[model samples]
Target: MTGDAEPASDERTPGRRRLARTVLTGAAALGAGLVSGPGPAPTATGSAGAASSDATRRRPAGPDTALRELAEGNRRWRTLHERHPDETSTVRRALLGGQHPFAVVLGCVDSRVPPELVFDQGLGDLLTVRSAGEVLDEAVLGSIAYGVLELDIPLVVVLGHQSCGAVSAAVHADLTGTELPAHMQYLVDRIRPAIDPKLRGDARVDAAITANVLLVRALLAAEPELAARIAAGRLAVVGARYELGTQWVHRIG
Candidate 1:
């Protein structure tokens, strides 16, 4: 992937155009801060499937700022006061040019943890990738690299949630020693390192969940491109836990 920064902007990006799930309407105000993307965007809920969306402002200046923005958003979400920052028509038209997302969030495929809604971000504001248990392989790595190396995003967040199906399945498979289905075995094997042989019940699942997030976060941080950026203090890799019980996002690493 090549950097999509325009001549006039210090940073910019045009993501893979994947459909993102929309939790709240009008939260796509992604153009106000700095990031840009082609919008009016589309949420994962259209007439046939995903719906169309307008963009909004609330651009974060850099990595630290981006993290802060996410934390505050999560607070709003936790308290049920989500401002739903950037989902307006003006925000939509503004991003017609490109995107300059401040952060790249690697989250789970769990529907409840949609990064945009969990962090209260909007259109063009985030470059997000999802996989069961937040697993990392070639394609996932490429997506993260594209956002960091090519798109100039300064932060990468590995977000794991409570009672993750992937993690729970992995734990169950490990305990029962039952082989999972063809494709699912791939995920089960990948999450093995995060399992705790001594733990059981919710504790076991939770342990693996956190372990998986840290594992992925470390993997991304150590990657050649991200490592160099980290060495230069230009990029940061973090791990976070999104709680379904209270709609809170906690920094784990």
Candidate 2:
């Protein structure tokens, strides 16, 4: 995994090219805010199958193994390395009917930051929910609840990344009182309360991002169904920050 932010269109198919272009063009409108600042964009190498296999191999045993697997995957990713696994026709055929994903990842909607690629997961390995800033809304929280209460996903990860534009916007709102677009403003509102008032200056954006992740984790852990599972030791909710410079996910509180 490389630390740089690559265009999301690079890995999509030709049939989806036009759609992707439209998506990229209207990213902000779609409420998928852009990434701020700059770093070397990481290039995705190897086939999806290979990546998935590596993810599967790292998976922990039982219904509650996602946290460890994710940690290991991030380690592999940080080194500009991958443990490519073969995605054979048999494997594809086997997954035709259903999927039993081990973990549910609630992440930012940034195109440069796709959870599957970052975690090196393959088809049917993860249940992913994405929204700007990883902010918790009724619908987003319900989706995560479904994964836990119904799908029985073992782990829930609130994944934030460095240089997140959504977070930066929230920080801006906190400091300068600048308002964001109407639709996107909700994200700021949801994340705003989580921002640490004591923290200030340029680095506040990064701090806000991590703060939001911690907030999401707390929210998930407190959710009724999720809370039950957690109390029973059947599930875990963890917060992580992905470094754009190293392509590694740093586990935070």
Candidate 3:
């Protein structure tokens, strides 16, 4: 969750070794492959083992309590502390056929803004979608709806970040008539309406980021399936911003 890289295998403790073995065996049966599309099957236990091993090392708790845990984990990350718990093989093997992630996050496509790292979560913990400016386009909305209705994820986070380049571009285009390419301009066009004309300078950027987060939250809450779940008190949506310099997230609502 801290966005820190995984520790070396030699550094792993005895408990971690046992867990890794379990995850690997399961991955073998499931025909686990890399993040990329399916390729050749794992050749040896060592290869298959690496997949589950990595997964076990990163696996987090169920979705029901994931958000609260994420907030707590972020605090630990900011404090430069490590709990260093190991995910057991039993748990890893059991989860091969199914997973129940707790929360869904709509974040920006910025490479530096990975939600798992910022929130200090591991694999299988968050259902994540990334789009430039965290914009609410049809595809993005559909993805969120799928997570809510099909996955039954309990919480949705609209994560905008500080000093977002996408928001800045939109602001610049609004100030000057300089035309952007049709495809790139589409992104600006979506973000432009979220900008508060009353605000200018740095405040303009900040307000635009916050407004976009709110707008996305509203859009998700208004989706028929998502809206019903929210009204029934079965789901919640919130907004936040990740500060690049500080490597921390501040909740906006």
Candidate 4:
């Protein structure tokens, strides 16, 4: 991770190439016969099948492909047409060799809004990071950077949701000036600035949730590690909000 004050605009192309090689080596070792399952037996070294699968999977998804896949998957989810791709033993075995997930989702730590479920993607398909209110922190930023910079994931989605408890709490605190507990207060403090002081109740919380997603998206787009990729058209950062009742995710930003 680079300094938060400015984008790390130094020449990263050569370094990215080096990192790709390193990841290939590390992935091979990590994937060999380490997976636990009732499925296919593991070979002493990895099977040729896994290698082939890895090769096919390693083709980096472009931003448009990534977005289209997610939108199609979400449609399946909301329509109860989910195919639940990639959960099979074969897919798991292939993943033992390496993961080439297409997107990075920075979403709330809310139970109802699991990224995999919302997008209807299976294992090894997404690199997901979560926090209450999707707050930005060093760890979260580093995780996202690893996916975009190392894994070469092309899409990053900042996922917010309706009736978010974190944003609701922040709205409550802002309206009444009632301080939350120390740790929870940390989440509120991070979220408070995104809320509109004039809006009240549900409207305030709903607007704040969308604002928070945009805020995180902006922060990511400005990040040195990610910004260069965006400029080169190698990566995209988007904002979306999930409706719990309809089980649909709508692009908000």
Best by lDDT: 4
RMSD of 4: 14.8
lDDT of 3 by residue, 1-253 (tens): 2233322222111110012211112112211211111123323333345445544454333332455566655544444442322234554665687776677899999998987777656556678999999988788888888887898877788888878889899988988866798788888888886777777687777778777776666666667786676566677676666766555565544
TM-score, candidate number 1: 0.77
The TM-score measured for candidate 2 stands at 0.74
Kindly list the per-residue Cα lDDT of model 1 for residues 200-234, writing each as its tens digit. 67777778887777677766766777777776767
lDDT order, best first, reads 4, 1, 2, 3
Residue 216 alpha-carbon offset, candidate 2, angstroms: 1.1
For residues 94-189, what per-residue lDDT tens digits would candidate 4 score against the true structure? 789998899999999999999999987878999999999999988999999999989999888889987899999888887889989878988888
lDDT tens digits, residue span 1-253, model 2: 1224332321111110011211111111211111222344345556664645443444453433455466545555555555433255655676787667788889999997888888766677789999989988899988998888787777777889878889888888867887887788898889886676666664566667777776777767767777777666677777677777656565554
Name the better of 1 and 4 by lDDT: 4
Runs of candidate 3 exceeding 4 Å displacement:
1-64, 82-92
Provide TM-scores for the models. Answer: 0.77, 0.74, 0.71, 0.76
Global lDDT of model 2: 0.65
Question: What's the number of clashes in each of the models?
Answer: 28, 6, 5, 3
